[model samples]
Target chain A: MSDPIFTAENVKQHYLIRQGMFADPIVLRAVDGASFVLNRGRTLAVVGESGCGKSTLARMVTMIEDPTEGRMTIDGSEILPGAASRDAVLRSRVQIVFQDPYGSLNPRQTIGKTLMEPLLINRKDVPAQERERRAREMLDLVGLRPEYFDRYPHMFSGGQRQRIAVARALMLDPEVLVLDEPVSALDLSIQSQILNLLVDLQDRLGLAYLFISHDLSVVRHVANEVMVMYLGKPVEQGPKDAVFAAPRHPYTKALMSATPTADPSRRQERIKLSGELPSPMAVPPGCPFHPRCWRASDRCRKDMPTLEGDAHRFACFNPIEA
Target chain B: MTEITETPATATGPAHPSPLREFWQYFSDNRGAVAGLVVFAAFFLVAVFAPLIAPYPPHEQFRDHLLQPPFWQPGGTLQFPLGTDPLGRDMLSRLIFGARYSFFIGMVVVSIASFFGVVIGVIAGFAPSWLDTLIMRLMDIVLSFPSLLLALVLVAVLGPSLMNAMIAIAVVLQPHFVRLTRAAVLSERPKDYVTAAKVAGAKPGRLMFVTVLPNCLAPIIVQAALSFSSAILDAAALGFLGMGAQPPTPEWGTMLAESREFILRAWWVVTFPGLCILFAVLAINLMGDGLRDALDPKLKRS
Candidate 1:
């Protein structure tokens, strides 16, 4: 009923690949025509193979890279493309938690300084003492001892560092958090802890999450909705329950079947697709996923499939029956 | 996902060794580095109290005692323990006074070079475009010349004074810092933390200076230490060539120059100033090596 906290319409990001002095520059569409809306307290998990533009989409959401084409509205305010044109207020509304725990936090900065930076930068009116108090509070909120504030990033374990990263993102009380594979780099045991922390944080703060990951099991636990991307384009999107139970697009069905299950006896029939992912620079003409898609037909090769339907939108000439 | 056990948060208090203490522990492990540090501290103290500690005023030459050997030798006295220069200035006194020149030049040149170099380098790296191209091109042109040669030219143009020599040495050293900082900034610019800072509404200046500059400091600090010694060497070289710290100034390089004619007869005149230069440079270089090893994250103790 209420307006979504974040909305993207036909977003596209293309990077110019220059081969040499003579060759014409090729346009590599890293994220092509991705459309989604995420409401407050909801998680939109973007699942795709490596180089499927999931991270690029996250970059667009975080406003680190502007979409070459499309309109993105954060909390009903539009985000412009150029560096100078970017709205600082809207930027403060959305923050990102990066993948590598070691690389994400500045190694030279103490945890207290790292956590206090966003607050100092975004909330300039806040006094230094107040900021310090808030940083200590955030450290406690993220399950870290306040005394750890003086410690540098290297002192913390990977999971603890990720928690610090999440805390830093929440320092400005942003409406949205773009998590780009936040737990993919962690060990299996630590993965669940971070996911639980994320879920708990989202529940407490009512924050929208654009969760980008290649790990389906992790997505299944954290995501309310799922969007499947192929190459650079989305092929399927729907509520997580419906999508996981009955994946409509052939690509989504294949992905769901490929996900490893704990019990061997409960394994479903595997649908392995053939061939490596088509290069984004030279994508198939009609359907981006056609080269590797088993269900791809002449019609699928001749014309692109547009997403249709209200609740469970999918783009495929031959979608699986629910 | 449901089997999450809360790991009890351990308070990181006095029980945990601080990074400074850890650094010291590692630093103290290297005997050569500790010796270098002690030697450097001795030189620093001598430089600071050269006037009070030296047996005689640096310029108060003992014409009668000219060319005296060390105190251990026949002609040397306790008052002129290191003996007198060709100018009859106390060798020990002049050597003590010369420490101030070496240390002063090293500190001043490195400070000036690093400040300007880091500012320009960071700006060029963060705002890469025509501005970067222009700055880099200018640096390339400057770098193409041999650093000492460029210093020579600058000193020539500036007319051979202590201040001129300092400025010339700084000019010679600026390109190195610029390149070092630019390379560091360029690498750090694309890192995820930089992007995260941008997403968190950090302005260009804050992102470059606050987020990125601190990360680039380790290499810069190491380069600064190494450059300090080089600055001292270059200043001494200029003084030797009669372009810096002219007559009666008691600079080590001038002492060496003045004593060259008397070297065959009065060995202490040239030898002591030369040894002073050697020890000061060696101590600084060793300390710099230790710092590089200590600050290097890859070498951190497991």
Candidate 2:
């Protein structure tokens, strides 16, 4: 058992979008309710489709946006909905690596400046020479050369820039790092390199990671725990080996079956999900995934099921047999 | 994780030329631009050392050489090289001094316009929707009036003077910078780098001025160069209308106005001052085109 450093209880982010001048504003539940505890030295992977609010979850944890409704406890410091303080004390404990390395970095800033920005903004006590030293140290930690410090973001390739991004995130010595599709923008060969660097950084720093990605294969390699989401709500969540071995929720099963493997001799049936994700503006009556779930019965359409079971939790009326 | 061995993709990219050299490479690619730059440089130097370069005082008259033709002509002398105006003031000396006024007008007007425009624009871009709308609509209102008419009105209100003319021109030209900067800021504000800065504990002020502003500079730089030439033109127009630099100021436009009756007789006063204004505006516009080509990455041919 690991120590829980940050625990988010029933966190929700609902955006109010006004369609027209006369019509009433619609509430778009981007992240309906996600409750999970991030423990020390462990990676919790939030796996979902394009608009399942994985990035929203990461944004909430990284303090980019305040949650519409939630109670987050990070090391005794409480964060409430719409009242999340701009206090650097709590913010300095968490950092983020955004997707698109080219876009995430300030083009005008040099690598050293990018790495040093977090400290400059947050840690006022750190001296200039010490900040430079720490920045150079993190660069080497992320497998970049010392001379790359003075270079601009446009000069580096996707992989090198991702390395720089990772290095920049670690400058504040954050306890938690929210990695939002950290390698989704990189090449296939470069993805593994960044992944390895992330794993190495986690081990050395003992950092808790909230890794958000749609890629299952990458998630399987990095995550200790997995949370499968569909339409802003978690469908299944459990230990990495258990969820992959036996996905109880229909949505989770479909997602797990979709993960492509390179084995030719072993045959597996791919799960085909019909139709596109429904518009978040108008969700169905009962269970959000009921329309898409194969085991959808009359009961499932009327009443939504709560997440059950002790270790491997699932939210489904009729779950698949493990 | 196994040892990953692969050189970064951009490592092979044509040995990274310094940014200045790269800019020059693109700038010099256009032969017209190089010629324009050379001509602009000569004008700049002439402006800088006007007193030393000119043959005589710009205001000093040579009554003996009144209405004289160029030195190449029969009646002309080397002392009055480009010939004399209706008042016997040397056209060459006045034209040299006129360069200094043009540079001053352009610099002051552009600086004032861009500084206020960028500040207001950046604030508008980062402001709430209502504020942004209010600022944009106000700018639109300013743009609705014919620019020269608006400038003339401002100059008239301020009472005809050089400083007042420059200020009027700046106010008239400000809408362009505001529109340009606001557009740039609107596009660049939602970018990931700014978001990253916010996540890294950057305050709103820091995000607006430091993080987002620098990335939105390329377009503004191009717009600034184009505006610089226009500012000079507007100032000249004001001077021509007697709402700018007053009588005997040696301003190109004032010179043209003073020698208006001499157009048929002297020819040198009108022709020389008109040529100075024409060549200066042309050269600056050419350099601005070069700036647009070099600064805007999309317009650069692969």
Candidate 3:
């Protein structure tokens, strides 16, 4: 395989809960030892329920946040913690599209002003007229009218606002787009429009996506690969077809069963896990998913499972297929 | 629209309108703002043209007209329609002349206090560290003192004069502006756009001004309006206590103070100046309320 556009190795993000000045801090492992790779022109969708540290992972990948213990690289440059200069280089190469389109764009600013911000910041060498030309080109590429350059964010609908956001991100001609639930905030129909737009843009621009979301169905439509997470840990990851068709991890199975399908005639057997997700602050010993895992054995509880497979990987010793 | 990928023409600033056209658009949409602005302009006119219009010098005493009522009064003269004070100075002339001093104090005090307060607040809020601790604690110490009492102490120490009163009131009022600005900046600091600006590689200075400060303007503006009226009231209060503009100066508060002895015998002396104070404060408060409503983005949508 060719060099991946981005790679995250054993990423860990621990949030400290300070009780008092003198007291010892309790560390919550929000993202624990998660790993992934994104190749050029391919998308890797990280899916999990809320609080699974999926968004944290996206922040890390985009360099908006730094992992407590891990190494993340874009192309060949390693991202350093608190190194603003290094981060800017990483930021120019990769951009993020936020969830709320209404809030993602500044209300006081016109679309033209908002889009020009990134280009002006990154490409100061480009002449003013050349910059305007590039901004208009970006707007057109995102399927917006050139006249909308003067209109404020309030004039646009949810989908159109998202389109503006996408256009703004594209101003720097970034290679990687870190979308944190980009389509989840829109209506079902509008979600498809945005998804299709993203796919079309990807094909045209040869972009890679680190798509973070909680919806597996949405991921299935756009993701080339899917990584399932449970309580800040990656339980399973594989090609989109292989993972969705035959999920090995029990949590993944439970999540898939919970998703509502459109076909009313088809009856799918449901798998329900017992109890709520345990707090990351007090994550249990050995296998973290044992409390709800149906196939939890003595060995599963005593020892942790590591990612062990060929191209596909699962951290579950008692995976269903196995 | 043509799918103009990689085109160079579209990235520049939008078409600029002439200054006259831009002003017309801004003012037309802001009629209420215009009305408040006009009332303030008239006040400015009164301040500027006081010397030209006053029939006599503000402090020049006419011994023959002592205790004479206003022209509209039963025994009032046409030359002094607003009548004379106990010192026999023209009430109308003195009030007109008082405009220059009052406005000077109001603007200078507010400007000084606002400048120092805004700088302190923005810096404290943006830079969260030992500096924040030092600044916030200093603000808290200042806030612990009652503003009027602090001004009174300051005026006593500085020796009472119009300029001294202004400096004292400004020092007393500085903490409130700092509190307002810090609150505004603190909340705006976490907004996603500021985060976006950071992600765009904006430096600390650019991010503070371009992203954070603009968003914080609405609240700061409202605070400034509220502060102006309160500052005016505090200045009048200081004058009433004889620690402000002093006797024969015809400042509203000093007028009230000097006329209180004759209030029963010549009620117009106190009533008109009190009315002026009342109208000015009410008008300022009404405009402030209007600004608070207009500046709200949620209210704008409704």
Candidate 4:
């Protein structure tokens, strides 16, 4: 098989925040030791709660935040944080779509201007006529009429705005799209429409998607692979079907049980985990999920378990049997 | 056809009115702002055609008509309809000529201050390092002094003159633009659109000026209008203090200063000039308020 489109090796992003004048600074390990590989034409969903560092990982992939350690390679080219000198050409290969469609678009800019911005910035050689042609084509590809190009963002509904945002991201013809909860703010009906559109676009373009969302059901529909994160560490990762059907890690089981099922007949007893997410500044020793894991033992609290497996990998000493 | 149905839906569908027409609609709705617009237009026209409109040259004195009340008063003549100042210059003519000074000073000071302040603010807010710290600290030091006092001190040092007073006031006003723009840039810097712009391969300069600056303009514009009136007021204060527009000049503030002694006898001398200042400032302020309401999208009616 050919190489994956994107590869990250043990990426780590740490921030030192001073508590007070008299207190010592604490280190926030927002994304600590995360490694993953994403190939073309596949979706890798990073599932976690609000502060599990999923967004930070998206930032790393988009090169918005420089990792303190580790390395990332896009299309076999190494790129470093704060080193924009590396390759401007490689930078355009990856683009991100933010969560808030309203806030993600410049209100002052027309839809045509917003869509053409990436083309104008990245491809200076393209003529103005060609850029406009491509912008119209993108607008059509995203299910928006060509006339909508002249209107501003406020002229469109939430779902239509997100379609415009999607079109804008695709204007550069990027190979990888890092969608940061692209549909979380939309209505349920709108969410399904956008998801179907994304699937159709991915099939046509053969694009890789780094889908970051907290909704497990949404992930189940869109993702081929799943990586469960807790307190900035990946606890389990595997094919979506395998991981969802037979979860090895206790945290994954808890998460799966918490997801609401549409069919009442398939509804299972919900597993309620105790306590809130611990502060990333002071992560618990050993297994990060030990405080909340029902199967956590004295051994689980003494030594950290490393992720191990060929097709399915999980970081837990006591695994649930299939 | 789908296209035929879609066209009208897109045109009159949402609350997305054409920006220019929407601005006019909002502006015309406010009675005070409409009045202000009329007053400002009249003042602007008077300033532009001062030489043509004024019956006598601003400095030309009519010895017989000194302290003349007005055309409606017992001793007033139609030639000097508004009246004559203590210097015997036509009060109506000087007031017309004085509009030129007020408008010119306001525009010059605001333009210079806004340009420099916005440039510095965009840099400081976007860079966010030692440069940001240094620029903000300098702005803090400048802002520590009261605006009028700082202008007074600068005028004293620069040697008092109209041009010097304008320069002093611009110096006092530039920091406000810096603070305003910096605060705006700081808030807009972390917005998702800005990040999306960066990921789209926009360089820092383009992001700061094109993507971020346009979004920050509504507040800046409202501030500019409000500051225009303040600039005129500051210039008048300097003229009144004898630090701006020296003797023989018929600036409104200087006319008031010259007529203070005879105010009880000839009320028109100080009252007309004072009313000129009051009306001009009031009109501009009302227009500024209306602009603030019009530009904000949140305040728009669905």
Candidate 5:
């Protein structure tokens, strides 16, 4: 259970956005210090508000773009900056499933061609028939039928298209998959089906998953461990049960209360936090979430707090205990 | 095109129409496009069968028929229905043969312009900011010149002839396609499919030409159609300017050029050729409109 298949150490992705021709560029710290280790057959859900650098982190782990700073490794191979371009074997070890299934798969390509693309591009040594065979096998593994082999993506519904996207990610037999809001675009009924398909695939293959989502309910349903992020940095990290049961950070507690529960008879205290998330360009000087935190102290406003604690960890000067 | 794989292959479902069939369905809905198609089809057959259907050879001179009026005119004879040029060449036969030249010119010019334009544009779109800026600035320089004048200068340097004229037109027209393709590629480059391809380890060339290029094709196709008609117009303009197909080649514009002086005396000499160019260009423009309506999904009615 403790065997790790993927790891990232203090990963930071900063983008310099130019203001104008004469103005100096401001750096957007998209993913400012993300560290996590994923065990095989387990899922790590990263929950954050929109623009909290969730997708940026997914891009880093998937090796779509190298992190501006820090280290990432998949199946023990260290993913150095620009190494994905030079060393494809290391890149192919991890794949990504995107949020918009409609946008992720090539509209021009047929479903089988879409599935076969990873193999075609990476495993050129494999014969055409072999590639076709493996692709069809993957379609079945993703719970799609055999007849979908030649149809374009527009013909399928959102859930089916997402299944195709998942199938494409699995085509190369990657040890890890970065699911970037994989179910957010899907209908509520369809979401559970796709989630079940993902869980089944994970169980059968023992693949590690870095699931990114803003929806706390979906995270609770699929994740073994959860990391709550605010303003491009993780505010709290722990096992899903522990974090969901007792969120130590102010931001995490606010996020958790916003999630609706099924128990109609039970009265729930929805913690209404004030102030919207600050723009990443002008993040506050001290604690990033201090502006919205009810328990903010003068010390919290003066000095940035580092993530501190044991198995259950949070970054706050004056913290709440559960 | 098999049935969609995700759905169960039940024979009861409506069959997905072929893309061509669907395109035709949408295209035929535009009545003006269909009418254009009919007119263009008749014109195409005339061009294809010019040698067999034309009563007289395109260049054959009936010396007595010089500047003869059309068959409807008082002195006109049925032998030359649309009348003759100053050279006594049958206007009908010459117009028929001229269609062939126009078609040939349009095909060649569009092919040459689009091939180079798409290639360069995709490169520019995929290239880093510095290289992209450099390529676009160069395209801008080319586009800054009035197309016909630039083509005239190019043909002047290349020496006036049919092939050289086409080469000039293609060079002049290439910038439009390049701008179009680059715009399309820029929009498409950020799409998730392109990122997926990159994540799959597709090389840069494959990503540009194979993955990104296909998605950009709808706009390119519309541009190509529009460019097709313009190519003909430009070629005819060049021919009229004596920078394109030379005399006695039966080109419509050259026919107009040959009879420029005779226009006041013998209206048929210029009128027939002018009408031919107008109708040909008009029909193609209508077809291009239809293509745009069909290819752009946003324009499709619910």
Candidate 6:
């Protein structure tokens, strides 16, 4: 296979939690170790519950948050941590679609002004008039009318605001779009429309997506491969078909079983996992998911599992098939 | 997610006028602002046409007519509608000219303080950690002293005069504006528009002015209106204490201070000028209230 458009190697982020004035600070490993790669024209979905550090990993890949250890590279250049270089590279080649569509755009700015923001930032040798024309085209591409250029953010509906956000992201024509729960905030009906838009945009632009979300259904539709995270660590990953049809990791199986399918006639035998996800401050002794893993052996509690296998990696030594 | 920007709910509700028309709409909707405008206009007129309106030249003392009462008083003359002070100057004429002095002081002081404060505060707030820390620390050092006390010291050092008083007050007032502006810019700096501006590769200066400052204007404006009253009060207080405008200048507070000893013999001397101070401050506060209400986002929601 050709070189991946973006690749992360053993990315980790540790946050320092201060306890007392002069006391020693405790470190929470938010993103223990996450590794993933996205091809030129495909989406890689990182699926996890809240506090699972998927969002942190997304920030790391987008270079918003610097990793404690490991490196993330886009094309061939290694991205550095500090504000100046990270912001420059992130702004031009990669853009993030924040969670809240309403909040992502500045309230005071007009929609046209909002869409033109990234284009103005990167400049990219595009002529001013040509930039404006391209911005107008992007609005059309996102299914918005040309007239919205003068309106403020409050004037747009939630879904429409999200569309503006997506259009703003594409304005730079970035190679990678990091979507952090892009449609989770919208209404159920609106979610499908945004998903369809994303799919269509990916196909047309030949873009790569680092799709971060907790919703399995949306991921199944848009993602080529999926990585399941627990307590800031990836437990399972593989081609969407292999992972969904025959989930190797117990945590992955538990997550998929809980997702409600569209077909009412087909009843899934849901596998209920016991206990909440352990806090990042006090993750379980061995495997991060061991406390809630039914298939976890005594060794799973004593020693953590490591990702093994090719194409379809399962971190668990005693996976479901075992 | 695809946000449909073309046909927003608010976009179709009603056609909005151009920005100028929008400003007019805002002005019309706010009745207190209209009333404030009227009062300000009348005051401006009084200041401009002081000679035409006052019956006598301000310093042309009438030795025979010392301590003359107002026209409504028992021993009053129609020639002096408001009355005359112990110095035999027409209170009406002095008040008119005094309007010019007081209004000039307020505007000049506020403008100077606001301009410098806004620039410093925005720069401090938008800059990185070390710079922000350094600027804010300097502001804190200035803020450690009471503004009135600081202004008094500056006036004493600079030599007491109208221009010196204005400079003194502006010097003292600058720090407050800097703090207010810095806070306002800090709150607005994190907003997505600023982020967008950065993404657009806007220079730091352009982003601070074009993107950040406009959003922060509401609070700064409200603070300015409120500060106008304080500036007036401060200038008057300094004048009353003989540290501001010298004798014969007829500022309201100084007039009150001078006439307080003769208040029983001539009530109009102290009462009229006192009333002027009270009413002017009250009107400005009410105007500030109206402006705050109009600019508030919470009110817009309902």
Where model 4 places Cα greater than 4 Å from the true spot, the runs are: A1-3, A83-86, B1-18
- Listed models, DockQ each: 0.51, 0.60, 0.34, 0.52, 0.49, 0.39
Cα-based RMSD of the predictions, in order? 2.3, 2.3, 4.0, 2.5, 3.0, 3.2
lDDT of each: 0.86, 0.87, 0.80, 0.87, 0.89, 0.81
lDDT of 2 by residue, A1-322 (tens): 7778999989999999998998999999999899898888999999999998898899899877888897898986787543334577677788889899978999878889988988998889999999999999998888887877876777678999988888888887889999999999999999999999889889899999999999999999999999998888988999999999998998988987888888978788888988789887788878988888788999988997888888789999899999
Model 2 chain B: which ten-residue window has the lowest total lDDT?
A: B5-14
By descending lDDT, how would the candidates be arranged?
Answer: 5, 4, 2, 1, 6, 3
Which candidate number has the best lDDT?
5
Winner by TM-score:
4
lDDT for each residue of candidate 6 in A195-223, tens digit (9 for 90 to 100): 99999999899899999999999999899
Q: Where is model 4 chain B poorest over a 10-residue stretch in terms of lDDT?
A: B1-10
For residues A1-322, write the lDDT of model 1, one tens digit per residue. 4349999999999999999979999999998899999989999999999999999998888877789999998777677775422455677788889999989998878899999998887778999999999999998888887778887777677898999999999898889999999999998989988998999999899999999998899999999999999988899999999899999898888887888999988857999888888888898888877888888899888898998889889999888888
TM match of model 1 to true structure: 0.95
Error of 1 at A244 (Å): 1.3
Q: How many residue pairs clash in each candidate?
A: 0, 0, 9, 0, 2, 9
Off by over 4 Å in 5: B1-31, B292-302
Listed per model, the TM-scores of chain A against the true chain A are 0.97, 0.97, 0.96, 0.97, 0.98, 0.95
| lDDT string, candidate 5, A45-73, tens digits | 99999999999999888888788899887
Tens digit of per-residue lDDT, candidate 3, span A246-295: 88888888899999998989989889888788888888788899988889
Per-residue error for A42 in candidate 4, Å, reads 0.7
Order of candidate numbers by DockQ, starting with the best: 2, 4, 1, 5, 6, 3
Best by DockQ: 2
Query: How well is each residue in B85-146 modelled by candidate 5, as lDDT tens digits?
Result: 88888989999999999999999999999999999999999999999999999999999999
TM-score on alpha carbons, each prediction: 0.95, 0.95, 0.92, 0.96, 0.95, 0.90
Q: Which of the two, 5 or 6, has more TM-score?
A: 5
Reported per model, the fraction of native interface contacts reproduced equals 0.62, 0.75, 0.32, 0.63, 0.63, 0.38
Model 1 bad stretches (over 4 Å): A1-3, A82-88, B1-26, B294-298
Residue pairs clashing in model 2 are none
- Give the lDDT of residue A244 in candidate 1: 92
